[model samples]
Target: MGRWVCRLGPALLLALTAVLAIRPDWNEQLFLLGHQSARLLPAVFWRLVSVFGDWKTVIALLFPLAWQQPQRLPALLAGTALAILLALLLKGGFAVPRPPLVLPVGTVQLLDALPGNGSFPSGHAMASALLATAWSAHPKVGRWGAGSLAMVAGLVALSRLAIGVHWPLDVLAGALVGWGVMRLALRHAAPQGWPEEVAQRLLALLSAVLLLAVVFTAVKDWPRHHEEYWLRLVIGTGVALGGLLRFRR
Candidate 1:
C-alpha cells in the first residue's frame, strides 16, 4: 500500500498531462460532467468548497506542513512558486476565456464573481496540487495524509468546474504543472544537512509571519479582486523577511 501510494502522485499527474496534451477537446466532456452534476449542488456548499483552493486557504494548509518540517519548506516553496509561475505564463499565452466569458449567456450558473483574466490552467488547481505534492514528499505524512490531501486537491480542481469558472483541461493541466514542479523540487531542491528540529523552529517562525500577513491583507481595504497581488505579497514578504532571519540563525 505504501509503495503504491508513493507512485500514485506522479503516475496520476503524468497521466492527466499526457491525456490532456493528446486530446485537449476532452476538456469539454469533463466540463459538461461537472456542469451538469453541480446543478443540484447547494450554493453555500459550493462556495465553501471552492475556498479550499483559494490563495489564503493554500497558505493556511502549506504553512502548517512547512512549520512541522522546516527542511520541507524549500521544496514546498519552490513547488508552489514554479507551479504558479507556469500557470500564469500559460494563462497569459493561451488567453483562454473562462466559461462565463465564452459560454452562451445564462448557460452556466456561476457561484462567484467573474474574474477578469485569461482562464486556461486554473491557478486554484495549480496551487492546491502543488501543496498536496509538497505534503506527499515526506514519508512520515503517510498514506492517510496523502489520501486526504489528494481528496482536497481533487475537490479544489473540481470546484472550478462546479462553479463554472474553468474548463476541465485548465484544471487538469494546472494540476500537472503543480505535481511536476513539486517532483522536481523534491528531486533537486531538497534541503541538505539541516537538523530537523532547528529547521522546524525557523520555519515555524516564518510561517507565523506569513499567517499574520494573511490576516492583515484580508482585513485591509485592498482590491480583493486582485488575488495575485495578495499571493505575491505573502510569498514575497515572507521570503524577504525569512531570508534575513534564516541566515542569522
Candidate 2:
C-alpha cells in the first residue's frame, strides 16, 4: 500500500499540474461561475463547505483522531506542517495577487482577503489532500475515509478557482504536495487504540467549533484588519500548542 502511494502520488500531481498549466479555458469557466447569478447557490454551498475546508478547522478535527493512534500523529502533523510552511514560503517567493485584488471581475463574494501573497499553491487544498492521504492508512477508516477526504479536497481546490483567488494550476500543485506529504507521514506512523481515537475525534470537533467561531466573527467584519489577523494567529497558535501538549501525554 505504501509503495503504491509513493508511486501513484507523484504521477497524480504531475498530471494535475499539467492540466492546470495548459488549460486556460477551464480557468475562464471557473471564473464565469463566480459571477453573481452563477454563484447564487454555489457561493452559499462553498462558503458552508469552507468551514470544513479550512486547514485549521480540519486539523482541529483530524488531529485528535490521529492522536489516538499516536504513531500516526507525527506523520499527519509533519505532512500538514510541511504543507503550511511550504505554502508560506511560496507565498513569500511568488507573491501572486488574488483575483479580487488584480482581476477585473464583477463583485466577488470573497470570504476572506485574497491575501497579497503567492497564489501558486492553494494551502487549504494541499492540507485537505494530506489529511485524506494520512487517514487512508488507518484500518478503521481505510480507503472510504481517504476517498471522502480527497473528494472534499478536490472541492476545495475548485472553490479556490471558482472564487477566482487562485489559478486552477495552483490548486493542482497544492493537491500534489498534500498527497505526497500524506504518503510520507503514513510510511512512518500508524494509529493505536479506542480511547486515543475518541480523544482525537473530540478534539477535532472542538477545533472545528472554534474555527467556525473565528471565521464567523471575521466574516462579519470583512476586509479583516491587522488586528483580526493577530487575533486569529494568537488563537490558532494557542489551539495548536494546546493540542501538542495533549499529544505529548
Against the true structure, what is each candidate's TM-score? 0.78, 0.67
lDDT of 1 by residue, 1-249 (tens): 434645776577678767866785776677877877987877556666666677656766676566556777777767777776787788889999897776678878887777888888888888888777778777787878887887788888888888888988788777777777888887777666258766666565665666576657666726553334455555645653554455454
Span of ten consecutive residues with least summed lDDT in model 1: 221-230
lDDT value, candidate 2, whole model: 0.63
Candidate number of the best lDDT? 1
Candidate 1 yields a Cα-based lDDT of 0.72
**Model 1 Cα RMSD, Å?**
5.2
Candidate 1 local lDDT, residue 111: 75
Q: Whole-model Cα lDDT per candidate? A: 0.72, 0.63
lDDT of 1 at 120: 80
The Cα error of candidate 1 at residue 25, in Å, is 4.6
- Per-residue lDDT value at 128 in model 2: 67
Model 2 over residues 1-249: C-alpha lDDT tens digits? 444444575687698678756886765455556434436555555554544446766675565555556556656666777778888888788776666765565556665456567777788678767766666666777555555666777777776765557766677787888777777666754434235565565555555565566667567656645333444445565665566556443
